[model samples]
Target: MTACGYRVGGQGASLPTEIKVIAVPAFENRTPWMRLEQRLTAAVMQEFIHRSRYRVVGKEQDADAVLRGAVTSATTTPVIFAPETGRASAVQVAVRVSVELRDRRTRATLYANRDFVFREQYEISSDLDSFFEERDPALDRLARDFAASLVSAVLENF
Candidate 1:
């Protein structure tokens, strides 16, 4: 009988075996939104710490590998509107990023994506009292999601 080479499931750990420490710095923000980089960078660091086997550092000088990124663009557009008031009831936020993972010792890029785009939709509460409270949390959720996807892509080397 001929044997097929198909594997069972995901074979993780595509990074080099020598890479044990990773540095993740605050990504540069080119968008109009304030503190977007901070939130996204923090989320990525947290994801690596929680999900990966590598030790994460703040400075690139102290790590075996570096993950760098930039927030290239951000836009908010109304997706849903209130029928009675003819005003926006929900908004879709789209963020574009450029990310790269490089090996410090080898001076080679392990992974790079120049145009990673992520979008999330959030409901704009019609109640004025709770309106402002929803913005930060929604952004936080989006950042977390982006972080997870980025880390997965890097680890899987896709």
Candidate 2:
């Protein structure tokens, strides 16, 4: 038997059945950060393609299952202060993601988890370039890591 307990179509050879296709919906961002929805959606889609057995589908209607996620919290805190200027030298940013997997046809949840936190530190730049430049990159990376972990957890349980 394969990992997923299915045999190959013709050969009686055991092979894991592919998840094949999934849909990721735009995540709801409760934080003040506006672009998190788009960034997280993209990250989850990429994770499905990269780390999982599933192929990400462009449309929800086309998918066998749907993976939905939300950004429950995104926060940044000054961790280190420069003595000379009393300015923040380093900041720790954390992103919390909640995800659920559901069968598209039955609308039944297969797996669900909440408050998966991913954190990263960023150095304070001397000059302010843009808010997004400072925040979005780290947030995106956190989201991507969270997605990867989530996928692994779900697959392992199966």
Candidate 3:
């Protein structure tokens, strides 16, 4: 039992204890976005390093398990429009990602999600001079959120 005197799900719940090290490679970008995969991969690696007990490696040969990511689709849509010019005042970006984790020695699949999707909206600039490209920043935000959620999934064995 936990300090609260009640177990949440199971005793000592987590990924396999043997998985002491993890490797994360550059995500495969199936979409048109040039380096979105790199950003996402980097974010996930950073999250694991900061939040998990396992040692993270950049190469699969150095890890006990491997976490693979692939970006499937990305799209943008205008959510809010300027009343005067009919121009987009806000836009939403939707991204679909596939992720998998497997033990290197046993070759057993630990976790896999083929259709994970995340969407975020950012305000567009209607005023001139105030606009300075926000899609990149918005994507960074999305990557961070995705990484956190991914880490949680692994930690909980979800």
Candidate 4:
């Protein structure tokens, strides 16, 4: 029980107590977006470091367990269009990811999710000068949201 008397699902309630250190390597990018894996991997590592008691390491051999992930698919689709120019006014981005956490010593899988999906919607600027400017920031926000959800799910053994 927590101080509030009700425990949240991701307060390391299900994670093994012995897992004091974790390895988070660069996620594999199976999508066409270059360096997407790097961004996701970095976000996940940062989340683990900031949100949990586990120490994060770059190498698998130095950790008690390892968390591996891959970005499987990414797509951007126009969801809303401007009435005047018939151009996309808003777009929706969808991403699929695969994640796995395993114990190095016991060779046991702690958590596995092969089809984790995440989506975000961003407004497309009407001005040509700022059209592409929203993309990176949108992706950054998506990555952070994905990391938070992924960390919670992993911690809860969901």
Winning model by TM-score: 4
Off by over 4 Å in 3: 1-12, 128-132
Ranking 2 against 4 by lDDT, winner: 4
User: All candidates' TM-scores?
Assistant: 0.90, 0.74, 0.85, 0.92
Best by lDDT: 1
Error of 3 at 2 (Å): 8.2
In model 2, which regions exceed 4 Å deviation? 1-18, 129-133
Judged by lDDT relative to the true structure, which candidate is superior, 1 or 4? 1
Candidate 1 lDDT at 60 equals 98
Record all residue pairs in model 2 with backbone atoms less than 3 Å apart, i.e. clashing: none
Error of 2 at 51 (Å): 1.9
User: How would you encode candidate 3's per-residue C-alpha lDDT over 52-135 as one tens digit per residue?
Assistant: 778989899999999998999988899999989999998888888998999999999898989878787888787666665765
Q: Evaluate residue 121 in candidate 3 and report its C-alpha lDDT on the 0 to 100 scale.
A: 82
RMSD per candidate (Å) reads 2.6, 5.9, 3.0, 2.2
Off by over 4 Å in 1: 1-12
Q: Give per-candidate clash totals.
A: 0, 0, 0, 0
Per-residue CA lDDT of model 1 for 1-158, tens digit only, reads: 99896642222378898999999988999998999999999999998888888899889999999999999999999999999988899999899999999999999999999998988888898888888898899889989998988888888887
Task: State the C-alpha lDDT per candidate.
Answer: 0.90, 0.71, 0.84, 0.89
Stretch of 10 with least lDDT, candidate 3: 5-14
Candidate 2 lDDT over 71-141, as tens digits, reads 88888899998888888878888888888877777777767777677777777764566644766566667
Residue 80 miss distance in model 1 (angstroms): 1.3
TM-score of model 3 (CA atoms): 0.85
